[model samples]
Target chain A: MSTKSTQIRLAARPVGEPQDSDFEFVTTELPALGDGQVLLRTVYLSLDPYMRGRMSAAKSYAKPVEVGDVMVGATVCEVVESRSPKRGVGDLVLAYTGWQTYAVAEAHHTRRLDPGAAPISTALGVLGMPGFTAYAGLLEIGRPQPGETVVVAAASGPVGSAVGQIAKVKGARAVGIAGGAEKCRALLEEFGFDAAVDHRSATFRDDLEAATPDGVDVYFENVGGPVSAAVVRRLNKFARVPVCGLVANYNATEAPPGPDRLPGFLGAILTLSLTVRGFIQDEFVPTRHDDFLREMAGWLRDGSVRYREDIVEGLEQTPDAFRGLLVGRNFGKLLVRVGEDLTRE
Target chain B: MSTKSTQIRLAARPVGEPQDSDFEFVTTELPALGDGQVLLRTVYLSLDPYMRGRMSAAKSYAKPVEVGDVMVGATVCEVVESRSPKRGVGDLVLAYTGWQTYAVAEAHHTRRLDPGAAPISTALGVLGMPGFTAYAGLLEIGRPQPGETVVVAAASGPVGSAVGQIAKVKGARAVGIAGGAEKCRALLEEFGFDAAVDHRSATFRDDLEAATPDGVDVYFENVGGPVSAAVVRRLNKFARVPVCGLVANYNATEAPPGPDRLPGFLGAILTLSLTVRGFIQDEFVPTRHDDFLREMAGWLRDGSVRYREDIVEGLEQTPDAFRGLLVGRNFGKLLVRVGEDLTRE
Candidate 1:
């Protein structure tokens, strides 16, 4: 059986911050499920900063979505029909089905989720890519030791929140940096970060200094700009930085104004004996994915780790929701309810 | 009996290139040997780019050489008199005696060298700290896999020369970047590097491209400047950079002009999944020293690795020799023969 799919495609490469005119929406019938394939009906679509990179033709770890192609993303969906013995109708599964209402994917390509265990939508958030990114980047690259101070910016968001919480679990002091007083409060109170500094404050640098009494040891770098520049100065000797994302510069049309700080940073790196490693989460899937699933599950069950979601109501809201994700407008794990979640009903 | 010691003290912190006036020469009576101490007659004094950092009050891994203090460095010294069982009269040993004609040091602090195994001056260059810096940083951090392309700057110097040879020993393709055609010739003919690119040539970038047909997988970053910026662009996905030194920017009084390239570098790091690690060799002494000594000895004996020294005749030439070392004037490991080698007799 075939189903109609409403999709958003990249219309043009964004010059800077993506505008509405850069995306084109279309409706079409999806191809019938093949022999080892299942027909997926999208329920929740994730909106993330990485989407900005995919919208442009700039060089990145992943290939950009083409002009006429559906904007790619992680989606939690329900299997409506199946031609394979692996999946049954109405089974909830996690898939890379992009920003569309319906998709046909191979059974082996998607992982079935147990809705009875936790909220199915979490497959796109805390239990998914963002969570895994924090897990792999922190444990492998950052390697924060007990009593060491581990700092992360955008701390109210899914990846940063997970990073801080995981660092706490590893017995390190977790210091978080976020945009506003409210997000800072969430970081300290809800996310259980030992300290939280508001980056938007006029006294942000001083606030960061006050928060991290002991110098930073592991900086989980997900945001770049003045915030990262200030944090780098406060890093202790033998510090480690795991660069996962740079949301601040994703929309930059041109290089920022001079005096180039690269040499100074390199100098600091040499004098301090620092390690700065950049990574994409998918690279860790083979070795660390199983451990992440097991440990994170326990953290979630025991209430040691908590998460929040900012769920938008409709599929059409994806563009605006994504724009919000880039500028610190979304408070938590941002998700778009693309269609009805049958399992919730 | 007693002898007078001639020393060079830092008269002033240099603004750019260190001038002869920045150093003050003084002669003083050597103190009588105390218990567990040896009176050392300096033979070969090592002069390296790191000395520039020590002349300044800027924060670094090691303490700065305070004004009016004898400049600190590694030296090959003779045990003319001893009050300890660890050293006997006429024995040659490695010592941290700085730029001086004679010194009194604890016997326990010096490592006795076997003149029969190799030349005594080698204890300050190829068989000493600089050689170990190349070995530990490249093997530990760079981790060049077989058939991978490894690039190093200052390829004719002790550290870079050893780095290229060691990379070749590990079955990786070695590409050397040096200042002049003569050094580039030495890199290919004398050092056995697979390819050599002269950074001073007008077509350097194009030459580098021609050398590394497959991209660079490992970059041993010693000289940080325009050459480093160019090498950074040629790095492939998952490249590793072991930043042991930054000689090019060591003399700069102020930050180079704009637009700042730090963001772009960090962006490339993220997209390429690079590992940029900075280290001082002393940190690895506890763990990798034994292996380095054994393996490096084997490589040297088997003709898999070779090194050259540019020895200056007198102690007074240090100031000029050091100034030349910073600007790539020295062809190899720059050393000063501070006094007569009694072992030659």
Candidate 2:
């Protein structure tokens, strides 16, 4: 049989909004699988805001993806052929195979997914890195106490959505901040938030103030811009800010123009005794990953935690979809449907 | 016998720098001590940076010093007349007697100080609250691992000086940042810091970079402004920042003008995965104070820790000395010598 695969590669780093030229799509022949390795066909590709950081050459907790390399991403795939004792002809698995149609990886690198447990796509969204990020960061660092208000920006995204829901489960009030009225409505209804404030509203500040009467105890910061500034003003003494991302300024090339509010922010921290912690999900994997898998699975099963996916068809649409993820264009957990799901009922 | 006592009271909230009219010095007669109380004559009054927060009507971790009230402060005092069996006449003790020369306090409110254990004035400086602040904040939150770099600003101040020394004791590289060459020199010679960078230098940023080659793992932030901004750039991955004070902008009335840099600061937090925790020393007193006292006493006994004092003379000069403390005029722990120590050897 003919061995062929389609792949997406980074063409150039985008300045602000990514353009079509920033990615190159190529169709090439797949290499033959070796001993103890499996040939997998991509089914679903996760497009996340973090991919923007990997595209830029800026120094970060993780190394940036080199130009011309396959854009790094997490994918749910179907094992087409296996050369090892772990026989998997049609078994679905999770892999970090980047933006490619097919990849040859060691069988041990892929974790087999039980199709009966949950949707294979759920492994890339709710039951994966983004969900676990919310679990570990909020529980371990944020520590939202009962009756306290927990505020999260980008509240419709996977990480923020899970954060708001988990805070509710912990007996805390969840106040979600999203871009528009629709997302805000989704946050309140779909995500089960106590209050949802539209950051895009002209009266957003007042809305946030009205939403959090007792003031915010834990602010799960993912979007740092005017939204974060407004939220910071309403924080109570000894508030905990677990910074997970800064999607608002991901494409920033220079420092924002300023009356220089750094001094004021620092002063607030000193006066209010705030705790601002920044973390990546991987840091908590060794300690809390197992707990996350069990708890998140249980939450999904019980309908306590809900997740939404905004799927874009085909691997060719991955680059444009990723750009939309950074600018808050695509709602929910942005994903690209790479290939047909043969196991779907 | 008739007793005349002079006291400083807050007359009005100062707009920027405090003026003479902002304080009212009154000579009052002291009443006789009650059954369980002692008449105290203030010897050394601690004039700290936190007093600035108290003077303002702005909300803080602590309540503001109301207008027409005696400005609060910590003091080392002598018991002139004791009606209680717990305290003897001529006993030296640490008290929260504000800016008054003489006052009556319950016996249990004061802790007796032995002149044999360092000095009576040490109760208000290196061996007291400021010292404990450095100890607990650095050890508990800062958590500097062995061989890692620990950077601290206000290198000559009691809290910062102790921070550098304690970090060194824990086998970490201590880098002190001070305003002038004299204080910087003292940081290395007296406090035993690995390196002391003069923040006033034209090439301060370069100096900081050269001093902390491995990047700062722990930054005990006491002075916030350009010094802190410089330190933030050198922070390593997962750096811990225990924000103790922001003396630089204590008098700020409004948010400074900006192409706002707060977003950028948050961006760095996300990329570096840093932990910035702000705290007041009182919060940790119940849990860690006893351990601090034991370990600090041992450090002082073995000469592993050293401290400096910038003592201003007399109770009448408190208002002017307090103004100096906020502007970093006082070199070490700013203390006002309120009364004569006639018992000193």
Candidate 3:
């Protein structure tokens, strides 16, 4: 095994769509682990839409990734060596190892995942941050009551998929909006959503209206743009919108031209008594994270929840996979298979 | 006594600022009071900015007044004749008398107000709907903590003045914004706000920045326009905004030009974890109206909460007074003294 680790470092902040020139590949010798630190080999590196926000120097909920830093991501890793009693050499763990093949982290920073319990890659998808985001933002903010209609865009993606399924679990009707027929089909078939509308259809707005005949009660706002505008019009009185991400505009170089819709938006918020809240998953850690873990694990075990992954073959495909994410090119949770999984081996 | 009652009814929906041509005044004999009903002599007709929403045929939180219907408003009335044991002749009551000189109301529809306990005019001002709006929207939605900055616009108006005074009462720093120096002075001197910024000043943004040294935590949004855009830039993380009214845009015929601020606004909501809620004061009647009356009455009794009135005489002047309200012409709670207040006279 190579003692040197390879990493993709940010070369420049992209103006719009990230290009290969925006990232630099580097190979560096791994430093010896310190006391209470574990050496982790990256088996899967999670590439998420939020990373797009982090790449920009603009102010956001979290600090932006500085230039020349390893492109930040969550990773499922195999503990290759341990300097603490908390983790063993072959244990599977979840760590924020970024876009790297190997990383060293304090043992406290890693969470051990039982290999026999589920696939370790699930740690990068449904049972991880994306899942937690959907669970917290939907239940805590979107708050779909039983029989209420819940509408979500990017319904084939991890966060959106989970939101639709969880709305079903809570006895709410789930109506999903996705880009194509295939994704719309998956939303209905795989996620068990009550209705699926193709956002890319020429009659997108009409399709949304047809799907949500009673008007939407909870809108899990993952993909913002025209889809959001259409969804907002159909929101029932007292609708709750949990704004988790706006992947559609993450790569825009400038603001959209407008007859400023904000006033109209605020008007809807007032006249409809809508609750529009924006959040990241961490806020609910103290209150709901444990409940999420226990409930999510049970659901996954009982086949009540299902997840799909769109894995790229190598770390070099990170930029391309991420570009595809912004344009709805990926069918599921996008992740890079950075290295071979030793957990199963 | 004029046996005939005079009323101002909606003749047409105005394009921008309401015009006299939009209203038609008519004198008609009121129906005879029946069992459990009282003939109320309109002593004070309250003219609020929300009346503008009712004038429009557009969809809103409340149903709009149809053309030829009497314009809706709250009033302090005297029981001229009572057919129910619950109320007697010469007693003052709070009633929805609209823009009229007299109204016959069911006893159940009116609340008895003691002129001996407080000024009866207050039932239409600080102790009435506008006062409760600030109380409920600020406390329930804004949730300002002690030492945190709470900002409100239209500072000298009934709703804004109450928000500032109540925020100060709660140990929060109160910053008020008004359109002119006179109103700004009233905010600081009469209302006892910590700081008052003139939204019409050339240095308005700078004044707002200087006033809110600690970023704003609670923004009682009574006015929405350029002033709001400036205040929003300084909101803190986890800041709460209780959108009670948008008086600034109540007269807007077209949406303002923009670099589509909705995206930037949504981005801020996400990054700051903001809770943006729009509410009509009625939602809190079953929840908090009693507490408001008790606490506000105590505050008034002890001279802690000071109220101002811009009383315009005669129901015939409601259109002009209401027009003045939209432009900040009336400094305080705009009330039309439609009839003799025999409770004191």
In model 3, what lDDT does residue A4 have? 80
**Predicted candidate 3 versus true structure: per-residue lDDT over A217-314, tens digit per residue:** 99998888889999999988889999888888899888899889989988888888888888989999999989998999999988778999998999
Question: How would you encode candidate 2's per-residue C-alpha lDDT over A1-345 as one tens digit per residue?
Answer: 556888888889878877889888888888888899999899999988888889888888788888888889999999899897785788899999999999888899889998889888989988998999999999999999999999999999999999999999999999999989899999988999999999889999999999999999999998888899999999999999999888888878777877887887887888788999999999999999999999999999899999999999998888778878887898898889899987675
TM-score of chain A of 2: 0.97
Higher lDDT: candidate 1 or 3? 1
Q: Considering every candidate listed, which one attains the maximal TM-score? A: 1
The clash number for model 2 is 12
- Tens-place lDDT per residue, model 1, A205-260, is 99999988899999999999999999998999999999999999999998888998
Residue A236, candidate 1: Cα error in Å is 0.9
Supply the global lDDT for candidate 3: 0.90
lDDT of each: 0.93, 0.90, 0.90
Which digits, one per residue and each the tens of the lDDT, describe model 2 over residues B1-345?
757788898999988888889999988998877899999999889989888889999878889999998889999999989999999999999999899999889999999998887788888877789998998899889998999999999889989999999999999999999888888899989999999999889999999999999999999999887888899999999999999998888877777777777877888888889999889999899999888878888999999998888888888888888888887777888888888987664
- lDDT of candidate 1 at residue A28, scale 0 to 100: 96
What TM-scores does chain A show, candidate by candidate in order?
0.98, 0.97, 0.98
Better of 2 and 3 by TM-score: 3
TM-score to true structure, per model: 0.98, 0.96, 0.98
Docking tier of model 3: it is: high
Error of 1 at B186 (Å): 0.7
Report residue A199 deviation for candidate 2 (angstroms): 1.9
